[model samples]
Target chain A: EAGVTQSPTHLIKTRGQQATLRCSPISGHTSVYWYQQALGLGLQFLLWYDEGEERNRGNFPPRFSGRQFPNYSSELNVNALELEDSALYLCASSLYRTKVAETQYFGPGTRLLVL
Target chain B: GIQVEQSPPDLILQEGANSTLRCNFSDSVNNLQWFHQNPWGQLINLFYIPSGTKQNGRLSATTVATERYSLLYISSSQTTDSGVYFCAVEQDFGNEKLTFGTGTRLTIIP
Candidate 1:
């Protein structure tokens, strides 16, 4: 089985620009999660999407948003990007099941450089 | 918000040596996992150990849920084991949002 996959291995953008990062979950997986690994900030939970709904989010600003499509793939959008927004954005997926803990598999992160 | 702390922050060991990394969470967690972030920036899932002990080849992990602590052991370490080890946890069962710890950077010298 193929693990999670992400597009645009590297991305370059300037201040005030918008950046979009995409992720395709593993087959038969129904949950997608977004995370940001920034300098000094460590890895943080950006957003969580399951069953086409936003389930949870972190303490990031409103400009950091994302959506999950009908096919379980996800897209993370950063609007009005700042220099601090430059980081390695990672995507993960898992088969959602209630009351049972499921393992999450991650993708090769998209390295975003905002100048 | 739950806080996850990992130690010793950095470790350097010989290829044949063994090492243990520790993670402590502030609250009760229903989901806990260990991940290795390679040099190429890929987070590889190492283990999904919420409780008890699980071993995979040269690597093993034990999570003491009652004490809210987890330990990852790497036996006969290899240069390929050089990377950042991260521990993440979910406080609730149904809500699966993970809170990651500040990783431990491991360097294996060959």
Candidate 2:
């Protein structure tokens, strides 16, 4: 089975521009999550979507948003990007359950650079 | 929010040496995972051991959920093992979102 896949391995944008990153979950997976790994800062959860609905969000600003499709693929949108927004955006997926925790597999991550 | 911490922020070992990495969480977790981040920044899943122990090839991980800690053992480490290892956890049961640790950078010198 294929693991999680991401698009645009690298991206370069200027401040105030918008950036969109995409991720496709592994086969048979139903939950998608986004995380940002900033320089000097560890990975931070961005968003969580399951069954086509947003489930949870981190402490990021409103500019960081994303949605999951019916096929369990997800897209993360960063609007009005800032220099600090430059980071490796990773997406992970896992089987969705209400009570049982499932293992999450990650993608290669999109390296976004905001100038 | 749960905080995850990794010990020995960095380690350097000669090829064929053995190493142990540790992870500690501030609260109970329903999910615990170990990932190896390659130099190119791709996170490769190493283990999904929330409890008990599991081994794959030269790597083995044990998670003691009750103690809120986990240990990853890399036996006879190779130069290929050089990279950053991260431990992530899901604090709330069924909440798939992961909170990652600061990561442990391991360098294996040939």
Model number with the top DockQ: 1
lDDT of 1 by residue, A12-88 (tens): 99999999999999999999999999999999889999999999888899999989999999999999999999999
At residue B106, give the lDDT of candidate 1. Answer: 99
DockQ of each model against the real complex? 0.84, 0.83
TM agreement with the true structure for every prediction:
0.98, 0.97
User: Model 2 chain B, poorest ten-residue lDDT window?
Assistant: B89-98
lDDT of 2 by residue, B21-78 (tens): 9999999888899999999999999998889999999999999988999999999989
Model 2 / residue B22 / CA error / Å: 0.7
Candidate 2 stretches with Cα past 4 Å from truth are: none
> Which numbered prediction scores highest in TM-score against the true structure?
1
**lDDT winner:** 1
